[model samples]
Target: MKMEPIEINEITGYWTFLRNIDWRDPWLIGLIFFHIFTTTTALLTRNRINFQVILFLTLLSMAYFSEPINEYAALNWKIFSKQQYFDSNGLFISTVFSMPILLNCMLLIGAWLYNSTQMMAQLKSAQMKQRSRKEAGIATEAKKTQ
Candidate 1:
């Protein structure tokens, strides 16, 4: 029997769509929440390299312990068996190393870029204020001498 993949559009919205979800698996739900939390945290944080590293590690760990990956393996056991590829643990281990590393790098780069822009804007504003103050002082001095 052939199986149809779940359409992304089907689950694209609010919590009301929970009624349509067939498998109420806790692991799957937890993993989804974990990913959301880590990704959101990574994005919202400002200038915290250590926090980014921690979040990246959390995301990577989530991939290894992901219920979705296990479910997929179970559903396609035949395909997995046909190949000489390692078992579910192998899948988890491989993901633990790769996906998290990439995610961490991206988060770090984004944070760096964002912090740089903010600093540059502040510096420009300060400079402008100082220039204006100096000009006002010069104008007042000229008027006093006139």
Candidate 2:
């Protein structure tokens, strides 16, 4: 059997590539809905630990399923030619997979920093109250001894 090379034109720009994405793909749709659900839950939940756990799971799922997601994108885009696939795969992966992960990581980091700061403030307040109580006790003891 003989194989013939298939020709593929260069992808124009980010918008064009995005426009070509197959929104109907089950994997893509599922990921989108899952991400939305995670984000909503993270926002609504008061527990910082819960938010962190959800974000971690979301990131893990995104990383694990990236291959299948990219495969679908490639098939949808019809980039079957070896040279074309290689050339475009990086863009596909970055746009479809890495971008979401990066954005979510940023959100996770922001939430961590915000929660940490709030915790530190709380600890400081508690320590100050304890120190004041100790000082008051010491003053009372000195007065009794005098």
Candidate 3:
């Protein structure tokens, strides 16, 4: 007996692929929480290396070693009956998986830098206002004594 390959529609294939993702995975949940924590802390507190390193490692693990990637690749093959694209076609499966992780890493760093700059600007503005107030107070006292 011979079996024929089933052709997959783009929308249905993607929907099935998304459904196959294991949302219940504890590590993935933890990673989600970690991202939230890192983003909030970076925005609220002084920038630090430890948090950045942890975020990088978590993202790296998700991109490279997680079960979701392999599952997606297998599902792609099963649905399409062909090898997943790796630069052959305009669409690359692995790129789609990794781009978000890379973009988020850039965003984390950008957020930290932006927050730090804003804090510094506020500090400088406060210092200038305080200095101006002190000088004005001293001038008033001198005029009264004269």
Candidate 4:
């Protein structure tokens, strides 16, 4: 007796879709590498100017490529409004696309906070040093007068 093929329903189909993704695709690999490089630079760079430049470039690139990336994802995942087979594709695509953006924004905010705190600490130290110098000068003048 001949056996029939199993029909892929919503539950089983998603795993199949994920498994079928072409890991060897050059565009996908490039995108992965780019994100990695940018994320590491954002995390490790000590120079504020450099960090700002990298952040600007990253945002620019994302804006320039957003439409193409969305189209590519939709094509690969067969995401469509009419199809009920993979309703989760919208969530999946949004998550995949937004994660890097969210990460970079968080990093930028963290860097800003760190810089502000450092500046405040430096200002406090300078003020303390100036106050000490003024007190020492006043004491020396009083000794001279006596």
**Residue by residue across 86-126, what tens digits does model 1's lDDT show?**
23455432443345545655776777787889999999999
lDDT of each candidate versus the true structure: 0.58, 0.66, 0.58, 0.61
For model 1 the local lDDT of residue 141 reads 100
Q: Please list the residue runs of candidate 4 whose C-alpha ends up more than 4 Å from where it truly belongs after superposition.
A: 1-24, 50-89
Model 3 Cα displacement at 42 (Å)? 10
lDDT of 2 by residue, 1-146 (tens): 11223334434777765665655656667767866776665566546687577767778787777777667756664443222232345676776566767677677777778888999999999999999999999999999999
* Winning candidate number (TM-score): 2
Full ranking by lDDT: 2, 4, 3, 1
Colliding pairs, model 1 = none
Candidate with better TM-score, 2 vs 4: 2
Q: Candidate 4's residue-wise lDDT over 8-69, tens digit each?
A: 45236555655544545455467678778777877677466665766857766775566666
Clash totals for all models, in order?
A: 0, 0, 0, 0
lDDT, candidate 3, equals 0.58
Residue 14 displacement (Å), model 1: 31
Runs in model 1 with CA error above 4 Å?
Answer: 1-33, 47-50, 53-97
